[model samples]
Target: MSVTQQRFMRRGVTKFLFLKAIADAGNVPLRPELASANATDLSGAISDVAGWSLANSPIDTPDMGSPMTTNIPGEDKADSSSLTFYEDLAAETIETLLTKGVVGFVVIMRKGDVPASKSMDIFPVRVAGRAPAYSAGSDPAKFTVTFAISGEPTLDAAIPASS
Candidate 1:
């Protein structure tokens, strides 16, 4: 087997691995299946690194369709799809906390050596959190986490980069 493939299998699935895989793929647009596969690998890796099961904790799967929310009309429809996705997955991450009476948090990805998008390709993951790692005021560990509630997100970027 290829060395790269061998390396990938060693890591468990998680958002961190998901992003890295996407970045490494370069000009290649990452399909949902590929992303899901990596997330699986990354999760295991993270469990090993953190010595905890954060990667598979609530165990979620990457989206299996286009990042675009069905190309349907109305901004609300698009927004709902995007929000539901994050809510479901994010919930898993924070599910244990919820039953113990916890709600809402600022889940940050905290930038490192990670770079911004160059291909203009929107990552299919429901929520993305990134920042400039070397910037003075920037926290290298500060990353953004997408949030959702009541079947919709408070913020939706489905319209591309029109913000």
Candidate 2:
């Protein structure tokens, strides 16, 4: 099996086959509630993929490029359109797994992007938490935030340092 496919199996992400449909577009967290992902999470590669935390990314990524428009001869404006970029929650999950636990990461990619079908996949290593790690339903001590690292999708990335 392919490495990406294998990783998904290991994460128990196989619960959904729909991911295969848009694999190129990117993957989303199977369980979003755990980390509480948002648009910041699914904003895709290179703005430094990380879990959405106001503590770190206080501001959203600035606009990359304006949308294209067609104007007839001397027309003032044809139609206003704008294009935006975003990261998928997978990276966000990895980031969560990293901070809440002493985490590790693996960044995956297929060779030769000439076809544009090729892409990279990121996953996280389960960290040994400084505090004792608790499984769901065990009733261990919980953290303060509205969300605790649990069933939500966790990525290997850690929260960025504060400015």
Candidate 3:
């Protein structure tokens, strides 16, 4: 019997882009356009990223006739996500652009920057807050920006060929 090879992926290959010009009125840029010069590539500045998942809330349904209580999945919602970046005071950096109340789209390419092959997640978000994380020791200065998902996200969408 012949065995098939299974390969695993690494998180280091992921790419994060912040598109500040995208409006909050349900406007989603085409997949190909996400890699354009307009989008800010935040991969170099970011140190960590967390929570961009859509989770379901379970609703309990208890009936009078049944001995056991039943539950069903309720509305799906994307939880508040955050991105930690190495603080940059230079002009037009992410720390300056991701101020409070800023609205934009966060494009995450999980399978690398290959066009027309890998998939990505598009999140319409509003900047909830941005706070600095100062350390007393030898650690580098960083800041975390929280985002509230403003609209429905495009999950696992295919990346189109670059124009």
Candidate 4:
């Protein structure tokens, strides 16, 4: 048994992530920023890495008439990311992006005792919204919009401003 162990927990409200919409000349959020952008609590940015698969090819062996298995190095796959937030009538950034279908960058900043961050420029992201659901159940009444990353996302290049 090891005597030393690193124990840590995010007890406060400091644990959070931000996704800053990057816009181009056409006002698209498809480009990532150089630094962490100021993000709001409503903005939920989620990024994931696709698992690598082994690339194999069939090879002919001299001794054996059957084809031999040659294992190639596994290739790295691109990431799939998504951002979700409530529609803000005062600030129509997300609403406009969803309507215009523009390209932009999503900068992600994860804060803990040791902060970890990454950024990705997504293109042709599809934005969709849901109707305000009001029910007897427990849930907030708000229009939610989700942005799906459709293109190759650049990693760790730019950072968003801390909000």
Candidate 5:
């Protein structure tokens, strides 16, 4: 009997790349090449993340001909997502790069830093807000930056070899 093994996203292995770029005439940012020079790996700075998913609202279609109500998937919207990063003001850090109104693509590699042969999710996002999370305890200084997904994310796209 053969047993299948399951893989999980382990801490310190998952990578988040934030590419600061503008969209072209097509209203979509150009997909960056794998391991692009312009991409900034924000994994080390990021402490936590939330809500980077697309959700669909069902359209209720009830008819008099049937007792049961029929529903269809209407549209898919990228839910609000946020990344909490340890605030660092030393030179080019998360605080300086991720400011309000900055637009870019957020590539998430759940399988880790190994770019080749892995799948990644690309999200076109705008930095919506930035709020500092001050604490009186011994926790490190952190801030949360909210992202507004401008368009539908490209899910499960294969990561290519770096050029």
Candidate 6:
């Protein structure tokens, strides 16, 4: 097997990753205009750091050691992902949050050499909280947007062809 094939972990590129917001609550459509180059555009999306985590906790039974511990399936948990970017205060961007019209977020991890199959698409995340900060002490203004995974997230081994 190739060295790349034997590897279990693949390093993601931050530049290739993007965070998108859909005004409507539904499946995300992979449109050509949603590319990262047009991130500032209304049809495009924001930015995100790669390699965010997805995890779940398991219910356990006490005093079940010697042989094996019993673990019941608990609720699926998601670590909130935070995206930091400079605030341009664009009308479309500000309106999406101020008007509360955004429905969900999509994190797109573009495919690379390590993962030759396809890209990774994480979506349908709800906006849990957002903090748009401004400073007058020589520092630039930025926004920190946090999101919570809502319902069942579409996490696939490979990017879906229909996306």
For all predicted structures, in order, the TM-scores are 0.19, 0.16, 0.83, 0.41, 0.84, 0.57
Candidate 3 regions with alpha-carbon error over 4 angstroms: 1-9, 22-28, 89-92
Expressed as tens digits, the lDDT of each residue in 47-67 for candidate 4 is: 222221222344433445446
lDDT of 3: 0.81
Instruction: lDDT for model 5, please.
Output: 0.78
**Candidate 5 displacement at residue 128 in angstroms:** 0.6
Task: List ranges where model 6 is wrong by over 4 Å.
Answer: 5-52, 62-68, 89-101, 110-116, 160-163
**lDDT of all predictions, in order shown?**
0.26, 0.26, 0.81, 0.37, 0.78, 0.49
Which ranges of candidate 2 are over 4 A from the true structure? 1-97, 102-116, 128-163
Q: Between candidates 2 and 6, which one is better according to lDDT?
A: 6
Judging by TM-score against the true structure, name the best candidate. Answer: 5
Q: Rank candidates by lDDT, best first.
A: 3, 5, 6, 4, 2, 1
Better of 2 and 6 by TM-score: 6
Candidate 3 global Cα RMSD: 3.1
What is the Å distance of residue 47 in model 4 from its true position? 15
Model 1, which residues run further than 4 Å from truth? 1-13, 16-72, 75-96, 105-163
Give per-residue CA lDDT, model 3, range 41-149, as digits (tens): 8888888888988999999999999989999999999977999999766654776678899898898887877676546788989999998898899988899999999
- Rate residue 29 of model 3 by lDDT: 61
- Runs in model 4 deviating more than 4 A are 1-81, 87-93, 112-136, 157-163
Index of the highest-lDDT prediction? 3
All models, RMSD in angstroms: 18.4, 18.7, 3.1, 8.0, 3.2, 6.0
**TM-score of model 5 (CA atoms):** 0.84
Worst lDDT run of 10 residues, candidate 1, spans: 47-56
